[model samples]
Target: MSARRIDRRGFLKTAATLAAPIIIPASALGLGRKIPSERITIGVIGLGGRGTQVLKDLLKLPDAQVIALCDVHPEHHREFENGKGPRLGSTPARELVDKAEQARSGQPGKPCFVTGDHRELIDRPDLDAVLVATPDHWHAAITLDALRSGKDVYCEKPVTHLFAEGQAVYREVAARKAVFQTGSQQRSDALFQQAAEIVRNGHLGKIRSIEVGLPPGYDKPMGSTEVKTPPAGLDYDRWCGPSPKLPYMNARHHRWWRGQRAYGGGVLMDWIGHHNDIAHWAIGEELGGPTRVESVGWTTPDVDIYDTPVDYEIACEYAGGITSRISTKVTEGTKWIGENGWLWVTRGKIKCSNAALLDKSFDRGEWVAGPTGSHVANFLNCVRSRAACIAPAEQAHRSITPGHLGYVSFSLKRPLRWDAKSESVIDDSDADQLLKKSESRAPWA
Candidate 1:
């Protein structure tokens, strides 16, 4: 073993692979685990909150085997220092994997690998696919690199932090002809599909406005403001990736990073992919998203760490005269108002002016899409089938477009007219530049 030196130009610099624990207890031999060649091999990157959740799901797949895991932080006693959850980071994730394997066979799991660097996992020849559950900023870079390596990918949502990155991702996935699934899991829910069925079936008559209720982003100040030393076993610079080089603080890292503009767009950017994804689906737009975005009622904080809006009330106008309102003021999901009656739906419940809308025997609407089963299972099956998953890169890109639009509009304190046909702002170069800040800094570059 040699001392590892990583410069700005490279990660793990020239290391062949990470120092990993190779563990194979006797119980892992059979149990219920699929035999080699019968299972799809998986390498999971970004062992944070979302990554942990997705990893658990991937491990449960009867046809999938998670062989490798990666994260900047080596391990954590708990996923969040501030909150309670499963232990996180690569080592903790590996421990979870080992236990799961043992539980499967009443013995130790198969040999699993761990890495502090993603490059090691991406370059592994044995991996058939990679699950990218990293931060919003790291999604496109990791996805593009994995796609280039000729591996299928299941990347978490909002897919990319910036609009330009989404375009690059779309092109790379197309060029590789890789099977990719964006982690907007709502599409697989029968309830959400039913909601889509209602709107597309013409049961709503003519839709007038759709109101989407989102959470008010970190209302009180979040994360500690104090500057601190980068903790041992944590590579702060690597965690920042292509984002700006900021001083280290617990508040601006971990779960708290979502509050800052440098990393993510607060709750507005996060939930936009979930509920709005459903919103777009119900309408059945071939090329969906708002044609215009304006927000006069929003609250952007003056704090240095958390710069994104804490709350917003935005209006988005789409083609076919469809209009939408997104705000904390609305109910906590999507509500559609139309000429006949109003229908509202969340993951658990659906409310309508008339109860008959949810009748299974009623017209099921011609608007149909797949992932007939679980979201994760669909991605794995699609990997073998070479078919598109329910939530592809392009659809994920479109779903989050208006959130970006609303973000820019709120920041500029003005309304923006969008050319939906061209996917560009109308005659607004300054605003256009904000949407195009997708460049990765050195090393990541």
Candidate 2:
């Protein structure tokens, strides 16, 4: 049979025609294999830039197929649906199409289906797993739904917006016995893993403090602009799910959502999660939350566009007097300070307090193989093995807690006492409120 030319609109029409409560049978999806299966049917949610990259990675695996793609933006979906059919190339788009064609030719599997609403794809019996790459606000809800629907999940970093939600998600995953992986991909990189292992093995001596850095924030203010009509084929309401309804701007809609408070926790949660996670791993406390957090710094004076602090020094106190100071404006590198010496690490570079330590190269033989060759690969493997991923939901939630707490301290303009066990601010009602998410408008509610 000739290859199907289903586009985003066509896929949505198909999904609409299908009745509610669609059931996707596990047998039809062909999930799980003794070894890697010939084909692993998968679904893609939130097909923006990150979603597209993930799609490419899935295509690279010989056993995987992108059976369904979903996004709220019709234009974004159209961009993929109207693209040329399967062909070989280094680009993700090419790889996805090529894999789809491979499945259809009877050479291996089946072509992918595209849709606008992720709910449609989640209900598909033909899917082995779903990748949740939506904004931070939507992460917990979408993931919980997917897990409840009996699909394994590979969710993005800083897994939840609030501490309580993280706990709820942890309970849900545990109860369902679903395989879940958080998208803190740095754990899969060779250099990062080596650095973390070195610190954990006590090569860095008694841990003192960790310094984590993030890219600088925007200096200019976002001037007021009139609210224009929502673009065609875009479900703005659905896109803003779990977030307050606000005038649509280029920054809020696309990649710049990181700066917004409702959608993201700014650089603290975005960059600190990776670096702080490194510190957590190195300290051998990867599963627990920090005992305390304090922040000192400020962003631009304007409060219109972004409410998160742009520059700040946040400290996470752990057990045994070890502390990690996560900063957004610091030079790009991780510094581990201990009693004997300090080790500094960044991509392609490593340094030590004693110059001689830098000369001593470590052996790879002592290294334990991580979940996958890299972070994303690890998630895929965990879905099949039912093994715990390197950065599971609980671990990621703890890793980001310091950053979130730091932001709270900065906002409150005081050194707030944090109860790590309770995951709440001690005795402070206002600070306590920040630990939970506010109700979104109707529809999102």
| Count of backbone clashes, every candidate in sequence | 1, 4
* TM values, all candidates: 0.88, 0.82
Q: Which candidate number maximizes TM-score?
A: 1
Instruction: Report RMSD (Å) for each prediction in the order shown.
Output: 12.1, 11.3
Q: Model 2 compared with the native: what TM-score?
A: 0.82
Q: Tell me the whole-model lDDT of each prediction, alpha carbons only.
A: 0.79, 0.68
**Model 2 RMSD in angstroms:** 11.3
For residues 1-445, what per-residue lDDT tens digits would candidate 2 score against the true structure?
Answer: 2264234344435433331222333443233322324465677787667777777676666556667777776444221233443221113443465566676575744445666677888998767688888878888778888887888788888888766677778888888777778878877676676677567767767988878776655444433234577666678878788778778765555666667777887766777667777777777776776677788666642556777766778877877888876876666767889988888777677777766554435432233425325466666655655667777877787778777777778777877777766677888889878656456666654
Q: For candidate 1, lDDT tens digit of each residue in 1-445?
A: 2244223123223211211112333344222222235578899999987899898987887777899999998775332563364577888789888887887779886778988788999999889899998888888889988988878899999889888888899878887777889999988887787787788668889899999888988765676678989778888889999888789877778887888878888898899888888888888753566888898578777776788888788798888899988888899888888899998888789888978888766655444544344788878766665657889998898888888888788778788999866788999998888877667777897
| Model 2, residue pairs in steric clash | 24-125, 67-113, 86-97, 103-109
Off by over 4 Å in 1: 1-36, 77-85, 105-109
lDDT against true structure, model 2: 0.68
User: Which regions of candidate 2 are displaced past 4 Å?
Assistant: 1-38, 76-95, 98-100, 103-111, 221-226, 301-303, 354-372
